[model samples]
Each structure stands twice: as C-alpha cells, then as structure tokens.
Target: MEQRWDGSVVLEAGRLLFRGRLGTTHAHAHAAVQVVVVRSGTVELADRYGGRLAVSAAVIPSRATHSLHAEDAQGTVAYYDSDSHVGRALRSRFPTAPGDRVTDWTAAAVQSACPPDAPGGGRAAAAPHPAVGRAIDRVRSRLHGPVTLEEVATALHLSPSRLGHLFAEELGLPFPAYVRWVRIRRAIELVRSGATLTQAACGAGFYDSSHLTRVVHEMFGMAPSQLLRDVQWEPGPQRIRPSGPGLAGAP
Candidate 1:
C-alpha cells in the first residue's frame, strides 16, 4: 500500500504517532499496548470474533486482536514498550483496555505526538538507562538491514547478554522483538511513501513482499490489500485535526 506522504508525525521517541487515513486495517494484533485518542470523529474497534464497540477514545491492550475504522478518522496513537516502566504505568492509567476510554493522559500524550516535522521524530526518553535508548536509536537508524543485538551491543562496548537485558529491563520488549516491530513499521512507512510492496519489503529489511504482507497482517491485522485499498497520503505540514465525519453509533 503505497501513497503520498500523509500528514502525520511519528514522534515522542517512536512511541507516539498520528494515524492518518489509511482506511481500516485488516484484523491484526500488536506487540505493544496502544492508546488512541480520537480527534475528529467516532471510530469502531472490532475484535476478531466479531465483538465490537464504539468509542471516542480507547486504550488497547497488547496482543489483543482488533481493527479500527472510520471513514476518515484521525487520531494520535501512542505505543509503549510492553515491558518498560512507562508501559507498565499504562496498565494503571487505562485499567480497562480495548474497553476503557482514556480519561487523563490522552490530551498530554496526543499533544506530545505532534512535533515540528511531519512524519517527525524526536529523541527517546533516557529511562531504564541511556544504553537502552541508544540501542533503540541504532535499530531505528537502519530501516533495512539485518542488525543483531550482539552487533549493536558490540558497537556500544557491551556484551550481547548485557545489552539484551537492557532492552528487556528498560524498554520492556526484547531486542529481537523490538527490531521486528521496527521493520514492520518501517515497511509500512515505505509503502506510505509510495513504494511498492516488493520495494518496501526490501527497503524495510523484509525478505520479500510476501514476508511484508504476512507480518503486516499479523502485527496490524489488516491484510495488504485491505490496508492499501484506499490509502491517501501526502508529505505536508501536519497538524492535529478533528476526525471530521464517518462511522459512528454504538456497534
């Protein structure tokens, strides 16, 4: 699914971003828990077994199978490393995910997702340890390439075992798992930037388009065809906007 660069920001150290109109995603699950604050319109989140709920804003637990939709729903989606201190904090903040509406953190978190750059980025938080943050940056720096944790650790003058622990203890997600997720995200971004699936797959470190397709569906739930169905994107000065209109009513 390739399109022009939609006006969205990937911000707050890769933990927060604005989900633009890529239409509905295929049924998928995520490795990291998510908090979505609907800005313009209502969105319906449907679970795998067909159960559904309509909410203005929602917190979704990790590994939960679900898909979100609205004709043109726009929102800030924040992701937390499932094992990080902040990720653990979110459980308390939400209390009831995929069912709970955000009460306190949405406003601040959504604002934080927006930055000067469209598809923008910022430095990671120096939590858990600076080394862990550095490792994350290194992985993110290479969108397409096989980078082992050992390599990253070696570069940082640490053993693979110690660095792997940093990833787990500090970031919550292990080095390998985090790297996988980053590759998937990178492929999606490449597709959004107008690359074909094959190109995106290669550019984002996948073995092939088939690999990208399968993983995208697994991680995000939406199949490639479904996600790419009507993706509209652009490179622009992005800003927070109301979801506007589409898909509503308690499902």
Candidate 2:
C-alpha cells in the first residue's frame, strides 16, 4: 500500500525543509541536493543500480536518481540548491567520489552537520550572474503565463543560447529544469493559499491538473495530492538565508 506523507514544510529561497512521516516515493531525481535524517523507524534509500541502504540519515547529491521507502517512519528531509552556502557546505564536508551519489551517515553526524543555525544566518553566498538573476525574476513574474527562455533572453537583451549557458553555469541546472521548479513552487504556493489542485495547476501555468501531477511526481516522487495534502506550512523567507556555522568548518 502507498503511504501518505503528513508533515510540516518550510520553504526559503534555495532551501526547503520538511518534518514528518515520509511516504513511499518512486525513484526520481531533481537538481537540489537532498538530506534525510530519520528520527524513528527506517527509511531505505535505493539507487538506480540496484543498491539499497537502510539509513537513519543520508545525503543524496544533486541530480542523482534515487527513491525512498519509508512506512510509518518519521524524519526530516531538506532540499538545498547545490550552489547555495549550506549546500556547498554539506557537499564540502561530506565529499562524494566522482560517481557516488548517496552518502549514508549516522543520525548524530547528520544532526551535527546540520545544526539549527546552519540554515539561518551567516555569510551571504555569491550572487548569480546579473543576467541569470534577472532571468529568474522574470520567470517568477511570468509563471501565470507561458514563459520561454527565448522570450526571457530577448527581454534581458541576451541570446537564448547565452542565457541557457549562464543558467547551467550559475544555477547548475538547465533553463527548462529551473522553469519546472519555479512552476511547481508556484503551484504549491497557490495550494497553500487554499486553491484546489486543479485551480493551483491553472494558476501556476500548468496545462491542467494532470500536467501538474506529472511534473510533481517526476521531480518529487509523489503526486501533488500526496505531497500537498493537509500539511502545515511555514511562511517562507523572502530571500535565501545566509549560510551559517557547521558543515562549513567541517573537515
């Protein structure tokens, strides 16, 4: 039987945090680096290569395909932009081999690396290129309509090819992937504001509910209903929080 995810979610620029019971998730990959800290029961992390590790805590590197199997297990899951301060810190502290994607750690170690202050305040991360920044703002503003890289680039006075290159170089994800993320985030925002899934999908510029459902499941490993159903949501900060202490100084 497929389990339901019940938890609280906090979204900040470049970071998303969830605390609650984890549902079984299908194998999926996204651009953010993911960290899972299991508090009770077990959550299994499986890779595409048939390797499986039952972990209390683990970090899955960016864009690495994997799945989670958790039943009646309570834990925390955090997604971080690979280029953000804390994301860089975690990757730095727990360096992975060239091809390795998932690193399992003891619960204590995971907690220590991700201290309460780690997600709050510290030094500001380097800003993205000016064009990339503008392009992002443009995407957010146009989420209610069709947004295309060519149109965004034209408005920003850059060729589509140049803009696409910058997105990959600065954000570590392609332009299309970033657009999908923005759309999904916008849909979640609409749902949090009391819109039904169908309404949220249209409001977020998805073709319809099914389009939104497919995107959510592909990127997050759960249907929009399962992911957004009856969960507490903390107001997200207007901007990304500065990096804090912990993994930054880790060896």
Q: Estimate each model's TM-score.
A: 0.61, 0.79
Candidate 1: list runs displaced more than 4 Å: 1-27, 38-56, 61-124, 237-251
Q: C-alpha displacement of 157 in model 2, angstroms?
A: 2.2
Model 2 lDDT tens row, 100-215: 44443332246446642254622225535889878888888999989999999999999999999998766666888878877887887687676889999999999999999898
Give the alpha carbon lDDT tens digit for every residue of 1-251 in model 1: 32111234342334535455424555666666566666666566676667666656655655566776664555555565454444555544443334323233343233333322233232334555778778777887886888898899998999999998877665445687777777866775676667888998999888888887787677765555554544455445222222321111101
Model 2 vs. true fold: TM: 0.79
Candidate 1 global lDDT: 0.57
As a whole number from 0 to 100, the lDDT of residue 31 in candidate 2 is 62
Looking at model 1, which ten-residue stretch has the lowest summed lDDT? 242-251
The runs of at least 3 residues in candidate 2 whose Cα sits more than 4 Å from the true structure, single-residue gaps closed, are: 1-3, 82-84, 88-100, 103-112, 115-126, 231-251
